[model samples]
Target: MNKSTYKNQIKIITNKNQKEIRIDKFLKNYIQNISRNQIQKWTTSGKILVNKNIVKKNYKIKPLDFVEIEISIPSVLDHLEYKNITAEKINLDILYEDEDVLVVNKPAGMVVHPGFGNETGTLIHGIKYHLTNSNLNNFNLYRCGLVHRLDKDTSGLLVFAKNEYSQKHLFQQFYSRTIQRKYIALIWGNLIEEKGTITGFIGRDPKNRKKMTILKQENQEFNKGKFSVTHYKVLERFKYLTYVSCNIKTGKTHQIRAHFKHLGHPLFHDSIYGGNRIFMKKKCSNQNIEFLNTCLKILQRQALHAISLSFIHPRNGKCHFLCPIPEDFKTVLENCRNMFLQ
Candidate 1:
């Protein structure tokens, strides 16, 4: 490949012609922070080859069979450094905390981390500020104490990285796709199904950086996002709305909202995808309009909440955690019910 087209290449050598090392395993030894899937992609795309022959990722290494591959990825150096991260002791609702982890109830309208247009006053920034000059700093900046994240508009439980060891292990759980995350949401339709799953490929819209699209051609570039899935159960159905409890199997940006919207339903009060007067009026009684107005006043963002989170502790080998619903969400539900009563 042209030097301008490819970044770096690696050649693999082995002792004897052996079915010993799976092609992907042989690759991990050489590449740091790279996954087996990447190697397989390289193989499929003609980037990784054995003895100058294109092979599947399962190809075993032979004594003199050479493996050549090219890969390009951004360096961690491109990420923000710890020193540059100033912590702020912003009002964090610490639901659970210990020597190893911290679970906090994050409110809506709060960015979990500074990204996009949001540059400061994020959860990470605040945690960094609070943990400054403490044992937490012993770890890296990107993971001072965060395992996963909720969207800026989605309120609920978030586990933070308190140290480096926990950070790595926790991240491993998320990457391995084993983390259990559940959300509660008020949606704009009367969903008849009690439980079901939504699956789609989610990627950023080239036309709008702020949005993601589920439909894209196979083998497309970065514009094509990852496979996302959400399993949802209708907890309660209001006149024109439904409350859904969702367990996210694959966490992607706006997975719940996007999936529901794809099926002709968006979350309540969702500005981007939600219908304004249409859905809002469906659930509202004559009096619901007044109550919804009050609910809207308290709800700064979307009507979604991460009410629960459970995962195995990466260290001690035990199951752990459930964060309660935020007061604002509870208030919305209560008020929504009260509106229906009227």
Candidate 2:
């Protein structure tokens, strides 16, 4: 990858309406190449500087604020790339770095690994391009230094082990459910209770086998599902929306999305779980109904983020880390500031 491509920016002329808006949002609308989630991560890690200050991604902009952003593309991924592999040199936000591990904030749209339609430019490929041949065991399915995997659309703090011992120790901790994984999500409706926990058996939905579901009492007895647990507290409420902090004890497939759905309060953009479709419907008024079918494709993913992760350093026994909140989620959360006063 070319190191020279890492340093750059374009003038974002903002009018009065957007003068005080967050920096992360501006990039998403102006820079088509990058996603909002990526900008959010960079903001949290102090990668995206405004006038050379390490401002929070949620910092409101002033009129004519000259924003100078320095995004370092992942470096020297010699092992992850070959003669034919095309890896996009996208910038990754490194929260904390050391010889033993790297805590990075992953973006919402990035697929974690190569798959059916996304064989190129995945998080795995990005890692390989930046830190070639990471300390990963052959048995680790997600590869690279990835000890654990996050859903492609969920943005937030993820750990990457720099060596074999750290990888194994972190892996075992996650397997035993010792690591704390917390998330912030905006779901439809004002969740009445302040905080609570949700526990149930989760299995593949028989009708739509691709998705996971919380089995009912009758089906739980003989279910092939795993036990799932989530603890959450409502942060604030929008008109018909609620921002919540979700802590997962057992990381099953689609646990956050499915569990919230089972609560009758699916995430705002989770279309499969009966999330708001009219929001997209209103955004696509000019198109024909046939074209409209896929017109709202951009809004299919939910607004969720991984904000914090705390765990013991398996090898060193240090209190490892707690990653900051991604900016996009902050932007969404900031929208509910009025809710607290009301």
Candidate 3:
């Protein structure tokens, strides 16, 4: 409710054809990078108004309806005060940079942000150091303008805004699923179908807090998890493994891992989701087993990489970015092709 905390104000006038749409649904379609749950919460909290009156989530929007949304931006000072994270100098593979934004190729094994066990030497710390050391001025110091993140050990392109306005703009893109992300993953089994889609709710495992799991909506409590969808297309098939490209429609914690594990074909070498062991049983000589073990040693981590990312530039709304696969990932693919695909 604080006027000073408001970051952005959106105003919309519905067309004649938009009648009968729910207010929450209308807001979600009109605004980029906002979730329906978030819209409902805003509606409940009186942040959304129709013709100067607060509306409910299910209110049917009328033709020519006047809708206004006030978005509250979290304060950087509060974030800094609560977290004991500090900036440290580190190497970074910056792919692109501009006055308003930055695109970096985050290497595998590097944590994106600081956390309890990983309090330093993260991508955030590296970004902060890069910004402070460069000529860029008047940027948000906390979190160094990170709009989104990649899990540790998943290498790929990541975007960071240079200021608060760009941050909010980029965040909206992610929320509305306007940003395009594609990942290449080598999995344990030959997919029966060349292309498929996986749909399930993702939530933390009740028994193992360290891992994420696919939830059965009928068995779980209300609001226990978020709905997630992933589309995959097989690129190449080996004797016992398949190389597939995945495009996630929803960003959930370990969504791809959990969904693939649910499908019984976890990522190659993904120990957390049971991809580390050999899944297929076959009669093989000792030499063949040793060769397989050698391949596993070379491909040590999960055979997944964020190979592509595309999003509209917040400031100019023109520029797009795409990053190439890293050497390690390429090397693993080559090893798989030479050793198993042959």
Candidate 4:
């Protein structure tokens, strides 16, 4: 669920002046980071439709015609050989575990899975070690029963399925928006509203491929990014910082971070979104600057922790999982409070 669900759908309404183009070529130009081969595969598999009817890859587009492309893209693990992932022994903060699921408190700075430049020392490697050593046959070697993901720098509760059936069931809950996820974050500025919702279309930043941005109306014309929503409530407010609770309505990449940033209050220490720098200060003095630097060092990452997660157990349907904030995050909050009090 860490990956955005909107990547599956590509909808377009042809402009009045739109020229006739092959459906595959049109899609390749419409969607960013998508290849023509992938578009053809989706078309051939009947995942592409024109005006509500399935179309061939070479189908010609027409003005005022509607096109909807549905893609069932495979997970990253599907492309990697299971044997390539080494099960490294690492200590995991187990929150809860059962025959069908496992809940763990993932620490900050831990990658959820191995990918391109990161091929080891990830949560997946540790999970593999734990499951294999425990002699559990429930997890697949590739995904290790993980159905969702957290960013490398985010710390908090994470749930993992124990089997294929449980994985599908849990994934469906996330896809359907039945799973509840609440995160605690210390942001850079005081929000004007105590509680509010942010709604925008989230897409990869054209300037920076590694970052996500809230698309403006003019920007949405061609990109048509996924719609994302997040609700936030202020818990405590300081002169320069605000503690808030964020509940995500859509699990897009960097949803919470991007939403908060769009509100002019990025999560504290979020270097990627420009929160690592000081946005507020009691006074422009060397002491204030030193204090802010110290706080940055203490946080080291985005000040976001997945404090709560509630989802029905895929097996029994009666089980729910929850976890408290981790110590590191709490310590940072306490330190910030003390600094403000002084």
Better of 1 and 3 by TM-score: 3
Q: Judged by lDDT relative to the true structure, which candidate is superior, 2 or 4?
A: 4
Query: Which candidate tops TM-score?
Result: 3
Q: Where does candidate 4 have its weakest 10-residue lDDT segment?
A: 1-10
Residue 97 of model 2 has an lDDT of 64
lDDT of 3 at 206: 76
Q: How does candidate 4 score on lDDT? A: 0.78
Q: Name the candidate, 1 or 3, with the larger lDDT value.
A: 3
Model 1, 193-298: lDDT tens digits are: 8899987667676676666657655535432356577899988766766888999887777888788888788887777765333464654576657665666677
- Give one digit per residue, the lDDT tens place, for model 2 in 182-226: 888888766778999987777788788877899875774323555
lDDT for 172 (candidate 1): 56
Q: What tens-digit string does per-residue lDDT give for candidate 4 at 1-342?
A: 232122345567888987797887666655544677888998888888899999888899999988887665454345335466788999999988877789998998899979888889999889888887876655555443676679999998899876555665676566556688899999987789999999877888888878888987587433446667788999988667899998987788898998898889999989999999998654547776787788788778999999888898976665555677766677778877887766
lDDT of 2 at 189: 65
Q: Model 1 scores what on Cα lDDT?
A: 0.70
Q: Which ten residues in a row have the lowest lDDT in candidate 1?
A: 1-10
Q: What local lDDT does model 2 show for residue 227?
A: 59
Clash count for each candidate, listed in order shown: 6, 1, 2, 0
Q: lDDT of all the models against the reference? A: 0.70, 0.66, 0.76, 0.78
Report each candidate's C-alpha RMSD, comma-separated, in the order given: 8.9, 20.4, 5.3, 6.4
Q: What is the TM-score of each candidate against the true structure?
A: 0.73, 0.63, 0.80, 0.76
Q: List the residue pairs that clash in candidate 2.
A: 77-129
Error of 4 at 113 (Å): 1.2
Which window of 10 residues has the lowest lDDT sum in candidate 3?
75-84
Residue 93's lDDT in candidate 2 = 81
For candidate 2, the per-residue lDDT at 272 reads: 68
TM-score of 4: 0.76
